[model samples]
Target: MKRPLLFLVACMIAQLSFAQSKDEKAVAAAVENMRKAMIDGERTALENLADSRLTYGHSSGLIEDKPTFVEHIASGGSDFVSIDLLDQTITVAGNTAIVRHVLHAATNDNGKPGKVALKILLVWLKEGGEWKLLARQAVKEPAK
Candidate 1:
């Protein structure tokens, strides 16, 4: 009887772990897709991920409305060579998730390589079985 109980517990634990891992993967993939859309200047894709009540904050102490952000990314005004994820942490609680990330990015600005290190926090909420980003804040790392 004891052996059977222990085995059942082990199975439950394994199943829970697997579920959590799947959730994490889903979140990661969603964020990666968002990043790719932005880099590829796909405003429509980025817009789809954004919540209607989005609050976006940027490292330059600027805040942008959802439409403005989409327009900016889609425009050729800012060119990105690469945007790499350095590290990320995601915590899920029921229908909400918070993601914190560090990114290494390079862009084209005035014919110069505009290198930036950024820390970002994104809050997502599940709406109708889809995750939408409700808020996002990014802070630039101080020049070293």
Candidate 2:
């Protein structure tokens, strides 16, 4: 009996350490959905994911509003062949979430294939029971 009880408690502790809060999980899911939409050039999904007043900034110092951002991605002007998000961390405070990650991507922009590595910061807001991207900024990763 003691051995089984100790094993159960240990498993419970492990599970607790891996568990995320409801909001945190939601934000993570939202981030994943956005990534998929970007790769697939899903116009509707990209539009829905972005807040009405989104401010998107690129590592090149280009800034775009919601309409421009969605249009560029959906039209395949900003095409992503694949995206990998690494070392991601999410923090939720009230209805806002701040997400940081290292993004490595294979891209084919206007028919030229390329690769990029960037550090990304995203701000999400919970609106109408859904997480929407309010802002995002990216910076090129420094040489190792």
Candidate 3:
């Protein structure tokens, strides 16, 4: 009886692990798509990736809603020349995912060239069989 109970428990654990791994991969893909859209200035793609009630917070303490964030990206207000995400981690909790990463990017915001290194946290929610970015926040990383 004990052996059977242990086997059952192990199988359940394995199933949970597999499910989490699958969810993590999906979340990572969603994040990558969002990054690609941002780099390409694809407003429609960005909108699709983001939830209708998105809260985007910048390193400079500015916060934007979904429409404002999409408008800024579309109008070249926050143009990313190149973005490199490093040390990314994703955690899935049921239908929600939390992602953290270091972002190093070369940016040209309205032709003002600049570089930024930031620690970013993103919240994604799985809704209607899709993952959408619900919130994101960035903080400037200290020079190393």
Candidate 4:
């Protein structure tokens, strides 16, 4: 009887770990898709990936809602030349996932070229079997 119980516990642990891994992958994919959309200036894709209640906070302390965020990307206000993400970590909690990453990018905003490095925190929620960005906040990384 004790052996059977131990086997059941082990199986449960394995299943839980697998599920977490799967969720983490999905969350990571969602984040990557968003990044690609941002780089491509794909407004529709960006709109689709983000929840309607999204709150996007910029490194400069500016906050934007979903519509404003979409408009800003679509309007060519900021164009990304390249984006490199590093040290990404994703944590899944039920239907919610938190992602932390460092983003380094070359950008041309209104024709002013610059490079930026920031630490980003993204919150995603699973809805209708899809992960959508619910909120994102970024802070400028100190110069090294």
Candidate 5:
């Protein structure tokens, strides 16, 4: 009986570990898609990932609604040449997930080319069988 109990515990541990790994992978992929959309300036891709009631905040201290945000991207207000996700950490609780990461983005600052580091937080909600970004906040990091 003891041996059987031990085996059951081991099996449970392995299953839990596997589930965690899978969750992490899923979160990473979703975040990557968002980054890719931003880099490519594909407003459609970005819009699809966002909830209809998305509250997006930029490093410039501007807050925009979903349509406004999408239009800005479409109008070339923001474009990323390269985006690197650094030190990402994700915490998931049921249908809600919080993704925080340091982002290194290479882009032209209003026609002046440069790279910038930004600390970003993205809140995602699983709604109607899909995960969508509910809120996003980004703050520019000071130059070292």
Candidate 6:
């Protein structure tokens, strides 16, 4: 009986650990959509996902508003060939979500192939039942 009870408790805890909240699920989907859009350089998708007041920061210390960010990404000025987000965490508070992840990507910025590894922090806001990227900041990835 004791062994059965312990096993049941362990199963419950494991289920709880794997479960995601509703908002967390939405945020994760949005993050994946953005990743795909970035790699594809979809201007309309990028524009739709970003809030009107977006503030995007780069690891190279460049900061851009919504228009600039969208344009640069869409025009291939800052191109992403492939993006892999690792060890992501999402926290929701009221209408805002804060997400952090390690981003490793292949890029072709201005026709030159390169790779980038960054630690990314992203803020998303829910407006009219849709999640939009409000802010994002990226920094150099820490050595492992």
What lDDT score belongs to each candidate, Candidate 1 first? 0.82, 0.97, 0.95, 0.93, 0.85, 0.96
Largest TM-score belongs to which candidate?
A: 6
What is the TM-score of each predicted model, taking all chains together? Answer: 0.80, 0.91, 0.87, 0.86, 0.82, 0.92
Colliding residue pairs in candidate 6: none
lDDT of 3 at 51: 99
Q: What is the C-alpha RMSD of each candidate to the true structure, in Å?
A: 3.3, 1.8, 4.0, 4.1, 3.4, 1.6
lDDT of 1 by residue, 1-144 (tens): 999999999999999876655556777777898788867878789899888888889888888878877777778555567889877888988888899998787887544678879999999888887888888999986677
Alpha carbon lDDT of residue 91, candidate 3?
Answer: 91
Best-to-worst order by TM-score is 6, 2, 3, 4, 5, 1
**Tens digit of per-residue lDDT, candidate 4, span 48-69:** 9999999999999999999999
Compared with the true structure, what per-residue lDDT tens digits does model 3 show for residues 1-144? 999999999999999866647789899999999999999989999999999999999999999999999999988999999899999999989999999999999999999999999999999999998999999999999998
Model 4: how far is 101 from its true place, Å? 0.2
Candidate 2, residue 34: how far the Cα is off, in Å: 0.4
Model 3 misplacement above 4 A? 1-20
What overall lDDT, based on C-alpha atoms, would model 3 receive against the true structure?
Answer: 0.95
TM-score preference between candidates 3 and 5, better one: 3
> Which one wins by TM-score: 1 or 2?
2
* Candidate 4 deviation (Cα RMSD): 4.1
lDDT of 3 at 93: 93
Q: Output the worst ten-in-a-row residue range by lDDT, candidate 2.
A: 16-25
Candidate 6 off by > 4 Å: 1-10
Full ranking by lDDT? 2, 6, 3, 4, 5, 1
For model 4, the local distance difference test gives: 0.93
